[model samples]
Target: MGSPLVSRGFQEFGSALQERRLRLLLAGRSGTGKSATGNSILQRKHFLSRLAATAVTRACATGSCRWASGDVEVLDTPDLFSPEVAQADPGFEERGRCYLLSAPGPHAVLLVTQLGRFTAQDLRAWRGVKALFGAGIAARTIVVFTRREDLAGGSLQQYVRDTDNRALRELVAECGGRCCAFDNRAADGEREAQVRELMGLVEELVRDQGGAPYTNDVYRLAQTLGGLSREERLRRVAERLAAHRELWPLAGFPSWAWPPCWALCCCCAFSAGTCPRR
Candidate 1:
């Protein structure tokens, strides 16, 4: 049998060969780092940001991130809680309703938030997010906790377990227990792991939709590596390779040693029949 990584790579390659675009919506309240995460994912400053509590994103902003697998369009949305924007249009709520229906519908809506102090306002904002997007949207949602380094030695799992934050718990349950953390300032192995987990969840959601998995990991890997300088990407890959070798002595030399190593690994594995076709 071929390696699972190689198989996944091939499946993603085949999907990319089809030239399908995956669209995703990034949603959350103001100050949740939704814009920051989108910028990080797209590896560019596509979304606007401000220090004010109620700065207006105004409308949905779109950006694309290209990878070995395919291109993904990420929509950075305005704060759903913007009263002025909501009040300005008589049909605002209906417009919000039509937003999802107008598109192929997002592959996923990443609900983002910063680490520490899950407030009552946060819960209320989450409820509003669900209301506007629809309750069933949870099936396609992923809770992305940002600023992981600020957690003060607390894991996301631990934070969830310890908190009485009912809204957060419900949000996680809605997303089928899918949660990932990222530290926007750090572009290291830990950040890559979080992105991989997010991609894995996206794959599962796509499978559940009776569609082919996008293998977001391949795309995400390419995006991350693409954002780095050539030397930085090589250095990071070497570091990861060394870590993998230390952890798994039976593992062989990595065949895909270039910048898009993850994508290459998935492609080779899929071609060799190690990855699940479904």
Candidate 2:
């Protein structure tokens, strides 16, 4: 018989592969090892990775790599929550682009950060996600931590277990305690092993959420119908979507402004996981 580790890997990979198409959205700050995390998952340099003071990915970009089951796509983005961008975008203009790229909605939204470096910016990013996607989207989030090597033979779960950082604990708790870690620098098969663990978590999330992807209408309801019951919110969400479809024909953008806005948006490369691999 196969070892437990091998069996677990198979299960994890299977869970992700079961989906007709798996869409993973990676969102986080630029220097948080965000891009590298995607590269590690693909086990290739699919997204650009570097150190910079400002945001590197200014648009929403998606790259797909083949897994045994089929193609897995990862969407990377800039700081969609940045104060400058938020004032003008206000969840409508920019969000439409994200919705377009991820389509129906992403199956898993991976919030990336560095281990031991969850900063104020990180917290803001999390808040931005909830504000932008609405609080209900929290169920689909998985906190991915990069730079696993920094643990120095320690595990992030162990650190969380022992640390008194109240904010960090609450952050993880809000994510339903789902976490994944990636070394990013690992050159061996260890990378594959790490990704399998992540897929396993994705599978668990799907089961818990009854296999429903976070949809565009759900995103709309999240932003518009807060403080209402789920049933009412969903009903209103349907109405709003129906209205948009009916009115979309009459709505036209100013020729000059539309191009750049659409182009810039097409361009937030908008862009983790939890603890290190064992």
Candidate 3:
């Protein structure tokens, strides 16, 4: 609703976010245009995208484009979060390698969806993202809607503000009200414009994150610190972070405040009516 953060110089942002290459991860259900969105963001057709009954991206693919004295890397991933692909990465040969390819973790995770086609599966996709990346991942996540033409040039912010979809609105709120649209079919100029818009949002997210990218350590904490309640997990994560503070000390994060930036993820578990009270 205010001025876009695009006009600001990276030198004025929090700490040295400008010094590190910003990494992003593309995620969503099949046919939601994750790969196509990645190509559009990178301004190149590096990932395969097509309509089919089955999945097109079997594993994660990586791409990047330089932006204002730094590079922005993107990982277009498969639907590894789905129950069907739960075991697809047993040996890190498939989607599991995404963890390696994105080594330190992404600065932002784009949970891509199609405009005017929200479904239960869409909400579930957010849950899957939190599960794999740790609930704290929600702190740095962004909801991306493809097929912006469906809006007929209407306002995206207004649409979300007026939508009757409570769960969708909540998911967006959980991500700190960060979302963007993409018209993958736009012309070269408009396509670049859309990418620039997304970069602005990503930069804003990084700034809000205190100039920290979500790290793999949080994901590791998720796997190793299992079976605990949400509160206990948060406590343990805080305790464990002291041992690995060097990993993201530049972000100036506190122990319980996770993902090396802001607060821990409240989780998408609310969609199932099981979300714990804060």
Better of 1 and 2 by lDDT: 2
Residue 31 in candidate 3 has what lDDT? 81
| Residue 152 lDDT, candidate 1, scale 0-100 | 60
lDDT tens readout by residue for model 2, 95-123: 45565567667888999987766655566
Candidate 3 clashing pairs, residues 3+ apart or interchain: none
| 1-278: candidate 1 lDDT, tens digit per residue | 11122237435643843336666778776787878788767665778865665655766678886644566778887765332333433334333322432253577778887665444445555655554544566777788988778676668787766655555676677678878887776665555555656667766676676553222322234345656675555455444333322222121223242223222221234433453422
Best by TM-score: 3
Q: Model 1: runs farther than 4 Å from truth?
A: 1-19, 81-85, 93-102, 152-154, 188-190, 212-278
> Which of the numbered candidates is closest to the native, going by highest lDDT?
3
How should the candidates be ordered by lDDT, best one leading? 3, 2, 1
RMSD of each: 21.4, 12.7, 12.1
How many steric clashes between backbone atoms does each model show?
Answer: 9, 31, 0
- What TM-score against the true fold does each predicted structure earn? 0.64, 0.71, 0.73
